[model samples]
Target: MKNTVLITGSSTGFGAAAANYFAAKGWNVIASMRDTSKDKQLNKQENIFVTHLDVEDTASIDAAITAGLARFGKIDVVINNAGYGLFGIFESFTKEAIQQQFAVNLFGAMDVAKAILPHFRAQQSGVLINVSSGAGVVGFPNASIYNASKFALEGWSEGLRYELAAIGIKVRIVEPGGATQTDFLQRVWGEGKNASIIPDYIPFLQKSEEMYANLGANSDEDAVEKIVAALYAAATADDDQLRYAPTSDIQPLLNVRRSSSEEEFNSFTNGLFLGK
Candidate 1:
């Protein structure tokens, strides 16, 4: 029997890429997204089942898992890849906006993992691949909330791995730098209820944007492909290998964080972003 994998946010970006890659590798793919109606291409592929799964909604999460099991008999892996970016100064975010960001990025992924644990336990073998970001490792300007969400995910996955290892379940994190082809930036939500920018922060925001644009232009062009490879590595790697950094550009930053002192790391990162 082929191993089956269910991926959230599979309608686009790295999720969609992973679905296609796994299906091509002969694994049964559950290509899940929030809206199944928008799935016009992935569903047509053999061994790929496109379904609705809104990670923020527990009912939808359960329904999607049930549907996958019914179709594939057993799920071997669950990829938590559904999330969006909330960008701007921390003060610009309302309580509701902050809550919503956490709801989709952090809490939503946790809910999916929690929902699938029983099934994984029953099977005695399963992998949970949480799609994190480089921001999870190193903070970036104008993305404080996004960084926080990913950082939380990293910490959660690290602790959960130890707890789940004895039960034959594995937890891994894959961090991707920046993908050029995705609509990720276009989908990013701005500050607060009205999505308005604070006048005082505009100049700083523009500088940050310009810097990010330059960095992105210099980043690896095939980020999605690299991320898919990282996902595959995480799924199939040794149980002890918990973190996979897929992009070259981010590796140096992560290395700096790992090898430098707190003050040194902060100085380096601040220089990169704030031009200090």
Candidate 2:
């Protein structure tokens, strides 16, 4: 029998790409999103089933899992790809916005992993892949909350891998650099309550935006493809590989982060953000 995989946030971007990739590879795919009605293409595929799954909603998460099992018999892999980015000055964010960022990015991913662990343990074989970000490894301006959430996810996944290894379940994190093709930038939530009107922040925000625009312009054209490839690697890898950095653009930055001292790394990143 073909292996079954359940992926969250399948309505677009990496989640959608991964759904197609896995189904084409002959795996049964449960392509889940917040609104099933929005699924116009994925459901048309024979091996891909579209379902509703709101990561912030436990009931929806449970329902999606149950539905996937009913359709595919068992879930051999669970990809936690549901999340959004929060961008703005750290001080501009409201308590609610910060909480929401953690809710969807960190806690939501954890809940999905928790929900699937029982099934995985019973089967003695499963893969749990969390879609993290380059920000998880190194911080970037205007993404304080996003970085925090992904950093937490990276650490959490690292720890969980050890606990799950004895039971034959594997945990992995796939960190992609900016995926310009996705709606990620468009969907990023700005800080709460008149943040844009704050004059003192305008010039800095403009510089940040310009820097991001430049990065997007220089981004790898095949970024999504690389990310999907990484996900495939994480799902199929036999040996224990904990982290996969798949984007070409960010590899150099990651290297600098690893090779340079903390002060040097800070200087390097500061130059990028400050447009020095």
Can you give the lDDT of residue 245 in candidate 2?
A: 96
Q: Tens digit of lDDT per residue, candidate 2, span 1-276?
A: 889999999999999999999998999999999988878799999999999999999999999999999999999999999998787677766788889989999999999998989999898899999999999998987788889999999999999899999889999999999825334233333523413445677677666766777777868888899999899989999999999999987888889998999999989988988856
- lDDT per residue (tens digit) for residues 100-155 in model 1: 88899899999999999999999899999999998898888878888999999999
Q: Pick out the ten consecutive residues of candidate 2 with the lowest summed lDDT.
A: 185-194
After superposition, candidate 1 runs with Cα above 4 Å error: 179-194
Model 2 lDDT, full chain set:
0.87
- The whole-model lDDT of each prediction reads 0.86, 0.87
lDDT of 2 at 272: 89
RMSD of 1: 2.3
lDDT of 1: 0.86
- Candidate 2 all-Cα RMSD: 2.3
Of the candidates shown, which would achieve the greatest lDDT relative to the real structure? 2
